[model samples]
Target: MGVKITGIGSYIPSEIAKNEHFGKHHFYNEDGTRFGHENDVIIEKFKAITGISERRYLPKTLVTSDIASFAAENALKNASLNKEELDYIIVAHNYGDVNYDSVQSDTVPSIATRVKHNLKIEKPTCVAYDVLFGCPGWIEGMIQANAFIKSGIAKKCLVIGAESLSRVVDPHDRDSMIYSDGAGAAIVEKSSEEGGILSHYSATFAFEEAHFIYFGESNNLELKDTRRYIKMYGRKIYEFALSNVPDAMKTCLDQSGISVDEVKMIFIHQANEKMDEAIVNRFYKLYDRTPPKDSMPMSIDKLGNSSVATIPTLYDLVLNNELKGYSVKENDVVIFASVGAGMNINAIVYRI
Candidate 1:
């Protein structure tokens, strides 16, 4: 038996937070020192580096689980599968659900359970859970689903990556502008078809990188509050990703027995444009070739970094032909890769 994504979907929030929107906000250094450059200059530099001009923000009335369910419903429809037949529901995220007006996150009932509840699935055997492996959580969830299906524990699984990073960001931190909110999901199931998940790799480098991405107080220390928000060492993450991610992708592709020349596309996490390009370039260099034009389709320009939601969402967009100039056909080989908190990294070599 092989594991394949039979269907996919994504929820791109209607509300757009343009870079221009941050113009009025005060950005400060980690030490709470005001930036020497004005907000315009900072935003311009940010756009140049991250390639994010605007990002989607979840509406105030909805929560992470809500969007996750939306994406799940769409995927179910796309697959033409009955919801009651699903054997597992996996939701990947970092923060649970943070209200628009509050910093507290709600995680009592797992997001998967909430999604199952939202879908009104009554099957008691449809086990639901959540994975918090940082931005790679979604791909990790897919790996687990593949394992379950291969082991005869499941026939079908709904794996979702959803996050409201906007709800967890510190306005005082410039990195806050890099975050957004969104959800993406896929229906993975057993298939008799020839091509499916061929190989995968995962690693956690927590020895010294454990806290590279963590929660910390606002950059504006003048507030004097204990509430923490999403924080990270940007330079550290960039260097770490460049040094490690390409090797991980190469390892995954090699395990699949697919040569570098056969890869049609690579759905990498939409963390930063420059960082992603660097990783792909390094991966190609591993085989003594440069990356092919249009090999990487990026949504980061408009979606920002929505934590776990990036890859699946981008895949969904490309599949739907909403992402121009990128398309995948039957029997195509592709790679899915991501790096994030836990200082974790993972890659999946898949055949379409």
Candidate 2:
């Protein structure tokens, strides 16, 4: 038995924030000190490095669960499955809802619970929960669903990645610009077919790099704020991705009993265009072959990095043929690779 993705869904906020908007604001260092560089130069370098032109963010009134339920409803609809039919609803999120005036936030009822409430799911047997595996949370939720199905526990599961990064981002911090808000979800079901979720591999490097993406202190302590926003060590993460991520992808592909040439497409986390491209190139080099052009499609140019939502949202785009020249057909091998906070790195191989 295997588990396979049956449907995909996504929700992007209507608000479009361009690089210029961010340029208008002054960013500060982690210590709250002001940056000396001009905003234009900084944005140009950011675009050159990350390839992000614009991104979406939900209205401040909205919360992470609201974003998730939108995607979940669409996913269940796409699968022609009702919410009551779901055996599990797993939500992956970093911060719950920080819509309050204070920096303090809570996930007490769980994001999954809030989504279930949003969907009005009446099935008592349906389990609703949340996962906190950094940006890989959604993928980890999928992995867990695979285990549940393979072990004869669950038949269908909904895995969602919803983030309100704008709430957690330090607007004055340039690195905070790397994030946006969005939600993506997939419906997975047990299948007797030979191909579905083939294999998965992941690792947590929590030593020196653990603090690479952290929430130590607030850059802005004004406005009665006390929330810890996301802070990333860009160079350190870039170097880490280049060094370790490719090997993790290779390990997943190797364990799947397939080679680099067999994969029809690769869905990599939209962390950074350059870093993702380099990692894929290195993966192909392991087989002594050049990486195929456009095999790895990217959405960071417009969507920015939506954290855990990136892969699934991109997956939805490809499935609907919304992406140019990137589509998933039957019996095609696909590889997914991601590296994010928690210092988490993981890869998943699937056949459709």
Candidate 3:
């Protein structure tokens, strides 16, 4: 049986924050070259660089589950399915709601339990689990879901990618400017059709790149404050993307028996506008094609990088008819690719 995406949903926090408003905060320096001097300059830069003007954020009262729940409910509604029908739920997140009781284990079951109770899913026998792989988490989730269905362990599954990067943002650092809070959900079920997840490929360069982008604790006593924030060697990370993502895409396409030219769209992780351009340029040079114009659209300017939520949010935009000249059709091949912390890169082919 083929695995197919039955529904899609996305949630951006309700509080909309513009660059101008962000600039007013004292932590934002007017002469900071990282983001530019003036609010207008920064906003213009964000628009020119990332194609994003504004993004939403959750209120203090809301958590990652709140955002995921909204998206999950909407996904089920869009799919015309009940929550009780899901045999499994996978919550892909790097950061979850801070709960005293739920600190040590996977947060998916907790989030799933909330969803089940909210929907009154009395007989839901869903196995809920969490996956953390930076921006590649959703692709990993898709692969795992396919395995579950193939193994007859699950017939219907809900995969979600939700994050609240705002909580982890270091206000003093300009690097954190692009991050925001958001979530995306998808309903996947067994199908007889040809379109779905076709091939998955991923690789990690473990040596020098390990320090390029990291978010966990550090061994240095003097760097204790760094543990609480996300850190990145931006130039190094960019170089890694330039070298690795295209190659991963090529491998994924090869495994799927499809050439690069056959791909209608390339959905690279919405990491940054510059990184996206670098990947698109490499793809064009390698394939002699124009890199599918508008293929690497950015939500970073508005939403920052929502980690795993990037691809699903982009998918949601497509499903809502927000993306121009893009529509999913049977047999159409789409490439989902990402490079993030852990210095990891992944490419997966999907037939929509």
Candidate 4:
């Protein structure tokens, strides 16, 4: 028997921010030049390199819970389960609804209340909490949910990975141009089956290679400064992901008694196109097998790296015929791998 993912859903804010919109930033050079301004060059240089055609963002009036509520409701409906049956709710977010000023505030409780009210769910015994990590958050949440159920501590779990990254984006920085806002949710239930979450491997290298992905002042007064936005060492991160994730993937498959050659598909955190290609190429070299010619899937192009939400959102897109002809079925081993800003990497195998 194994824990199974019954349903999955994703929510992108209605507001769409495009790459061309960055043209309005007044940091251009005398020759009408700006770093990463050329569309094609920018696309080719970055890992997830497609110009983010459009991305969703929560309006000023909305918060993280609102985005989460939408995703959770859709996930529950897709799973054909009632919200009342949810034994636990796990929210994975690096940025919360309230700004840093309200870190001491009861933001978790308030967000929980709003989720319950919006979804019309009965108060759950385990109603509140947040998990802070880098991009590997959603995969970590799933691993935790599976553990909770396997321990008989929960019957069903709603695992949500949501982020309103626009709040942390430095409008003037070209690196931030690819970031947008979104949320994703999954409904997991315990089943006496052979598939579900087969194995998970996670590791964090806390070395100070290039640690600053997102930063804010320890004092509230620094909120107004542009430094408060996310800053990424793109080259270092790309190198880290390329070198680390392939080993992590091999470790997961090795522990699961499955060879990488046997797996049918791989779903990586949709960080960028170039990164995706690099990882996929590595897989090809390591296994000496081609990836079924179109099996590598990505959503970073349009979704603009929805952080933790990227994987699940890409999963939904695949399941909903967005990726036509690529079908996931029983006994097929699918791998989920991610590397987040904390120099953290998570790789898991799931059989469906």
Candidate 5:
């Protein structure tokens, strides 16, 4: 009784937004004060900190569910599984389908339902729903699929993490440069193979950190509109992750009975380069060693942070040999971890 990802796929947006794209834009502090430094200085500092040179943006004609379906279709094809055989379709996203013309997010029928409809999966028994646990949504979906398979309630499930962060970001906010648009999905099913998902851990720290990331008015006070966009206290979130994420990953790995040395890779959320590096370093420190070189494969340099989509997308690229200089072999152990809004943190110890 093992739950394993049989196939994986991702849809990286075709629209490339280089850092220079934001050079002409005005950036203001959270209190509406103008920056003393020029845009070039700000951009360089942002790149140095986030390791993001460029990011992808969804085109005007597409929405969140649209890219989700594309990734779902690719996963189904990669798995060679029939649509009708799927027992579940779970979509992990923060903002739903957002049109370029509207400031509102539409999730009337649920993104999973829309994805199923787009895929033409007519199986009424194929339960479809959405999860909004911040950036950890994708890994959480995978954990749910594992439970379903282990409980004998499902044989095959499609777990997708997709986001159009570009659609929800405030252009006036410098943090907007940390977001991108993309989709990634995996086909999880019961397998006779040896190793699969071994252990997982999740926690929410909402007591004092509930609003660490939220929807808020633009940093530019000149815009007198009542609209809100994705916003966060970058410093607070960074500190929160540094203090908690590493411990969560260690707990998950300890439960999996896999020693630190056995971990071949760690697919952490692409929130920030420095934050992720610190988290991983701390996780390795728990075992009294440093992270092995190439132990973490990152796509944030080009993709930015797609929230829930980051880990699955990075894993899909590596598994397909599409990510340069990174590859995974059979029997290799890996860890998937994430921290995001909801002040949530989660990790999954997996074996390939």
Candidate 6:
């Protein structure tokens, strides 16, 4: 039996944070100097380059698990399956439920565990756990679910990517503006029909250039001992992803023994519009062709960089025919690819 995504769902917070929501104090220049009101140029450049006009943030009452549970329920409902039917629940997140403080104060009852509880599942056979593979966590979960179904270890799995990013962002940090809160999920089950997940490849190059996105103090150039927030090297990450991600996708397609022209859609991580556009262009250029318009659908314009949630959420939109001029149909081939924080890169080929 092949593993196939039977259903998909996503949840974005109601609170919309716009680019102008942040002021001068929230940014700093390359030299660690303050980026005062004169930083409007930076905001303009970010929106122009990343295509992100706004993003979501959870209300004080909502946590990562709440968003996860909502999306999970929608996925299960879309599949016309009950919670009891789930053989596995795999949640992918970089940090657990972050409160308003943005600090991970708890981990025992994992985000997956919390989601399980929130779902109110009573079946003990429905095991649940979490994966921490940077932005590729959900893809890794899907790969693992494919293995499980192929090996007869599971009949159905609920794979989810959820995060409360606002909790981890430093208000004074411009990079934080690109982060958002949301969740996405899919129901992967065994299928007797052909055209499911076809090929997979993953690699880590941390030793080459590590700690691109890390947690550290909130102060200027100095790395303080205490405050905890997400910090990123934007230019370095952009360069790294450009150099490696496309090759990884091409390698995956090559291994699948399929022509790049056969790809109907590509659900890439909604990290940055310009970077993603560059990656897709280069991927097609390898075969001396150009990417078809609308071949790659994006959600970053509405949701910013939601890390692991990007692919699943985008897939959900496509599956539901919510993306204009972009939809998935049978016999179509789709490629999923991502590169993020760990300097980790992975890609999967799926046939519908």
- Model 2 lDDT at residue 92: 91
Evaluate all candidate structures by whole-model CA lDDT and list the values in order.
0.95, 0.88, 0.75, 0.76, 0.95, 0.88
- Per model, state how many residue pairs clash: 0, 2, 2, 9, 0, 3
Which run of 10 residues does model 4 get worst, by summed lDDT?
216-225
After superposition on all CA atoms, what RMSD does each candidate show versus the true structure? Answer: 0.6, 1.5, 4.2, 4.2, 0.7, 1.8
Q: Compared to the true structure, candidate 1 yields what TM-score?
A: 0.99
Order of models, best TM-score first: 1, 5, 2, 6, 4, 3
Worst 10 residues of 2 by lDDT: 218-227
The ten-residue window of minimal lDDT in model 5 covers: 1-10
Of the two candidates 2 and 6, the one with more favorable lDDT, higher being better, is 2
**Candidate with better TM-score, 3 vs 5:** 5
lDDT of 4 by residue, 38-106 (tens): 654553444345435656666877777888889999999899997888988888777677452333223
Q: What would the TM-scores of all predictions be? A: 0.99, 0.96, 0.86, 0.87, 0.99, 0.95
Considering every candidate listed, which one attains the maximal lDDT? 1
Instruction: Give the alpha carbon lDDT tens digit for every residue of 1-352 in model 5.
Output: 6789998999999999999999999998889998789999999999999999999998999999999999999999999999999999999999999999688999999999999999998889999999999999999999999999999999999999999998888888999999999999999999998799999999999999999999999989999988789999999999999999999999999999998999999999999999999999999998999999899999999999999999989999999888888899989999999999999999999998
lDDT of 2: 0.88
Q: Estimate, for each residue in 224-274, the C-alpha lDDT of model 2 and write its tens digit.
A: 555577888898999999999889988888899987788899999998989
- Which stretches of candidate 1 lie above 4 Å from their native place? none
lDDT of 1 at 53: 100
Q: In model 2, which runs have C-alpha deviations exceeding 4 angstroms? A: 100-102, 220-224
lDDT of 1 by residue, 73-140 (tens): 99999999999999999999999988888869999799999999999999999999999999999999
> Which pairs, if any, clash in model 1?
none
Worst 10-residue lDDT window for candidate 6 reads: 23-32
- Which residue pairs in candidate 3 collide? 52-302, 178-304
Sorted on lDDT, best first, the list reads 1, 5, 2, 6, 4, 3
Model 3 CA deviation exceeding 4 Å by range = 25-52, 99-120, 216-227
